[model samples]
Target: MNKRSPLDRHKQIRARLARRLFVVRGWLVLETVWRAAWPVGAMIGAYFALALLGIWEQAPAFVHLAVFGLVLLGGAGILWHRLRRAIWPGDADARRRLEESGGARHRPIDAVFDAPAMAAGASVLWRRHRDHMAETAQDLPVKAPRLSLVYEDPRALRAIVLLALFIGALYAGPDAGRRLFQALQPPFGDAPRTVVLDAWLTPPDYTGKSPIVLHGPITANKAHDEAAAPLSAPVGSMLVVRLNGGRQAPVLLAGEDDIPFDTVGTVDHRLEFALSDPDLSVLEIRQGGRSRALWPLALSPINRRASALSEPPLKVVGKPCG
Candidate 1:
């Protein structure tokens, strides 16, 4: 077997120590970043969750501004506090830490860079000491850095915030991100209350048909663009309109007449009428003097002849009439 020369052995030992030092340095940086940024991340997540759940939209403009300011200030303060106490490990510090973790009793890593004294006998001693240190460092242990923020959040509030964000995202559907941005904007006047408009056609009990929804609970701004399909219901069916949480009562415009909705509550309105007008070809719902939704009505006359034909023919049971 070819034995390594003293110079080669020295190079190998130094290289190994350098790699350990690099790892320690990286972990130190990572720890510092985590400690400083975790609180800020948690704050941001909680804010986003509220936005996604539409809590901000329901609040006044002042409340939105207040929340924004609080988040900004809290984040800044947390970062400043954590960063002020953060210690950025230098090369020497990294080397010391690595040696300590490896359970080195003597300062082996320091000896690697120590210079020999000028005295003649000191050179031999220094060389022997470095060799011993190299031997001890051969099986050095490197432990992973402590990156958990459990101590900072003892009550596990961060986990709750994460859960809220997930739930809110699902509840908000595809418009989750859009709702967040909308919540950030402080409205000029009082925040617009969410309006729910539900309108459907209920066929007569004799017709044996389920109620057909003409418009689901859509917001006021999108009602016109998101109108449901044209309504085709049998004549004598009842058209029911329910408007909830709107500032003004809703109006039903069928043909030329404008029928006002009956008050149901402080902000609830309901209208129900029989669809007997065969000439009526369209229906419209108006709120605050603006058309919210329009549906083309196609009323089909009941077919009595078809109903009769669907029944079994009268049975002629009389055996061979006389």
Candidate 2:
């Protein structure tokens, strides 16, 4: 009826509506993505805080939380698909949409133009009506008026705020920020243990010489002095060993010699045992029937002078190591 093509006019108006619908749908999707990120960010921030505080002794719950977050995000993605389907308009649906969105001028005129489009086949009057619709579509503005459908939602804005806050908190604390995504580990390691065992060898009256005293624990399969010095003594020297300290006692004493260390002297908070030799390895100490730890010691004769010597397994009698 007019200079402009009717078919193209119908198509143009439909395309504009579809484009607006698409934009609205895209906005919904973007909003969904934004909203989904909030809870996920909250969960992630919580994990960082917990890890920094060393609160994950039993099992880290973040794995489950992250899974839940992914599920929530997946739900949003699925909703996006549903929203798209709703936004897409069929031919009949487009007819109704055109009528509703006809605006002021076309609003006064009845929607006879879209009547043929709603049906499968065209009638004699269909061309005339379609042409009129084309003219009407041309008169309307290019920009559609359903912008309200595509505006950012308040919920989405709130979600963005929450996400931003969570992200900011993650970086605010250096201790927490550095610990994110790091493996959870125990805080403490084995503490350094210091056990001191001291011993002395005194010759019997027959081979009498002054007693030689060594102060220190035996370790590495050898009885050693505190300064790691050597001991020189003749054979058959009575070994008098005294292990000082409340925590370094031995349940059973052992050595290469396998000689018996007899209980000899006792003082306040001290017990003296006569050892056959100065070389011994502490097998284990049992407190209340529970075996504890074991260490090594080495001992042998030396010249009158003590010198740094090679370490060896000791053979000393039972001496109260404590």
Best by lDDT: 1
Looking at candidate 1, what is the lDDT of residue 109? 83
For residues 1-322, write the lDDT of model 1, one tens digit per residue: 9989977898898888888889999988888888788889999899999887767755656787788888989899988988888887799878777878888877888787566566876777778878888888867878899888888778988899999999999977765766776656645454444556788889866566799987533433444543545568888889988775445777888889999999753455789989988878878778766566677777988667755665678986767757
Off by over 4 Å in 1: 45-54, 80-85, 116-118, 148-294, 303-322
Over the stretch 206-321, how does candidate 2's per-residue lDDT look in tens digits?
Answer: 44368877443233423322234334555445444443212223334444332222322211022244434545423322222323223333444443432223334477889797
lDDT against true structure, model 1? 0.77
Residue-pair clashes, model 1: 0
Clashing pairs in 1: none
Model 1 error, position 260 (Å): 15
Whose TM-score is greatest here? 1
